[model samples]
Target: MRVAVFSFPGWGHLRPLLPLVRELLDRGHEVSVVVAERFAAAAADTGARVLTYPSRFPAPVPEVRTAEDLAQVVVAYYEEAFAALPAAWAAFADDPPDLVVEDALSTAASGLVADRAGCPVVRAFPGFAGNDEVPLNGSEPEPGSPDLDAEHPAIAAFVRGLPDRLARLGVGEDAVARVRARPPRANLVFVPAAFQPRVECFDGSFAFVGPQPPADPPPTGWSPPADGSPVVLVSLGTSSNDNPGFFLACGEAFAGTGWRVVMTTAGHLDGATAAAMPPEVELHAWLDHHAVLPHAAVVVCQAGAGSLMDAFGHGVPVVVVPQQPDARVMARHVAALGLGRCLEGPVSGADVRDAVLAVAADAGVAAAVAALRSAIGSAGGAARAADVVERVAAATPTDGGSQSAWR
Candidate 1:
């Protein structure tokens, strides 16, 4: 099988899909990855053939500072992405993919590619939010906050009509209808299923995929935390890592606690600030967080699904400080699952210490972490996901002059 994987530009979106790409390829299928141009080589490192696409926006769109900003950037991104379909179609058709895997926000192409090339498109949601219903993130505006008006109404409507759009590109209207009719695109949720009880709202078309196969190391070198004390990994996440004050606050929180801190400032933070750490804390542009999270005793992090999922996959407890729209939802899930505590907004050192201490000292919290880990193992999510994808592919027979294939 020739499989094509697509994620928007963000690290949060790309990281989860990485392991599955490897899984498919390891199972003896040809895989191609479509990602932002900057992330092309990163995907290539995993041994999949890489294809590049122009992102709707240029790099550095700024941090996910507020709900409004979240609404604005995401809305604009999908709007521009929808408009770019013609070019994207041309690029993919030049070398057609047998199967297309898509990240949460990459909906239009899912219907388009499957329609145009007669392939199966697997919709993967990176966050805990499984679909349009039981929203992992905010589907509707918060009660008190200014309503997040979907500014891109034109594209929003266009996305709703995606099946018809794909039909024009040769995906039969009924076939395209079947694809869109499945809520949230036959999604596979990468987070723990116990933490997510309401996924049924995605209409049984979706199934939990568990975490992507365990992440692997990049063929590059970056120093791991060398501090002597039990290591604590602190990261605000890929897009929200720009807060200098947050890092300074974390420094204060861990002071004298004897916990050597490893903070991945994600290149947005200044090295000088990290250099000034009070003897124990080590700060750097980025770390192989997936590599480090397993070794750390506790993770003090943004409620990025990528960051927390990596921590949970290793049975590590979390101290969540959510900074974005999705982070808030993720934090709630973390607390609900008993793995750790959630802290929103500008987190203080004292709060960080308290959450970390709570996770460390309380046997109950440790049990919660263990329980989550056990639940995932019981579910067999990765295998289940692979089965779902293959089953879906098999359901739609192709008569384009070739025998059917399976993994």
Candidate 2:
């Protein structure tokens, strides 16, 4: 089978899909990854043919201080991505593949391609799967917030113009509905079923495939400090690393403490700023959390789905300082599952330190983390994802009736 995997530009979105793509290739199937130009090299390393597309607008890096700001950021992202879809579609049209696997968030482009090419589309959720029963993030939006109002001017305009946009691409009116619906014919979620919101409500259409582990462990020269202090790993993921103040707060929180802090600044912190960090805190521009996480007693992070799953995979409890809506949702799920604590709204250094210490000291938290790890192991990460992809590929219609494929 020839599998075409489409992902948004960010690491959080693309990384989860790599393991499954590589697995398909190892099984002797042809795989090609369509991604933003910035990530083509990483995708190519999976041994899949790489197709790159230009992202016209810079990926948004918002300081999500309020719900409204987050809403605007989401809207702006969709606007920018939707603008680039026509060109992205044209690139895929030249060599359509047997099946389409796409990041769940890349609906604008993927929906059209599936419709035009009449191929089965499998949506991969790098984070939580959205449904009517559960909020997209873990919680409901603020009342009257643009995030909840589909009729908000920006989203409304996008929806209103969507038909004409599809028409221009030679897609039928039925494709408009697929573009709006959240689930695809089949969906793959990277988290274990225990972590999913409203898991009981989901039907057979969703597969809880657990965390996709790295195909090959990242090489790292650093290890736990040999001084016998417990390690705390701090990261804000790739796009949200602009928060220097948060990183500094983490440094201060652990300063003079027995815990050793290892922070990945993702190169967002300047040399002088990083040099000024507390002596007890070690800073790296980037480190494979997979290599470093097993040594950590606790992870203080932005609670992105990938980071949360990675931390849990290693049985390291987390202290979440969420920076966005999805992160907030994942943090809530973490707290609810007894996996860790969620710190919301203007968290200080003391808050960060206390949450880590509290969760670390809780024996029940440790037990819950262990249980989740076992569940994740049984959830069948990459192999299960490949199985679902193969099944969907076999079921796709060759005729132009794929607009109703999800049904």
Q: Largest TM-score belongs to which candidate?
A: 2
Residue 165 of model 2 has an lDDT of 78
TM-score (all chains, Cα) for each model: 0.81, 0.88
lDDT of 2 by residue, 342-375 (tens): 9999999889999899999999999999999888
- Please write out the lDDT profile of model 1 over residues 105-159, one tens digit for every residue: 7766655676667676677877665444665473444565544456456546756
Where does candidate 1 stray beyond 4 Å?
Answer: 57-71, 136-140, 148-185, 200-203, 213-228, 381-384, 396-407
TM-score of 1: 0.81
User: Candidate 2, 305: how far from true, in Å?
Assistant: 0.4
Each model's number of backbone clashes? Answer: 2, 1
Clashing pairs in 2: 138-329
Evaluate all candidate structures by whole-model CA lDDT and list the values in order.
0.70, 0.79
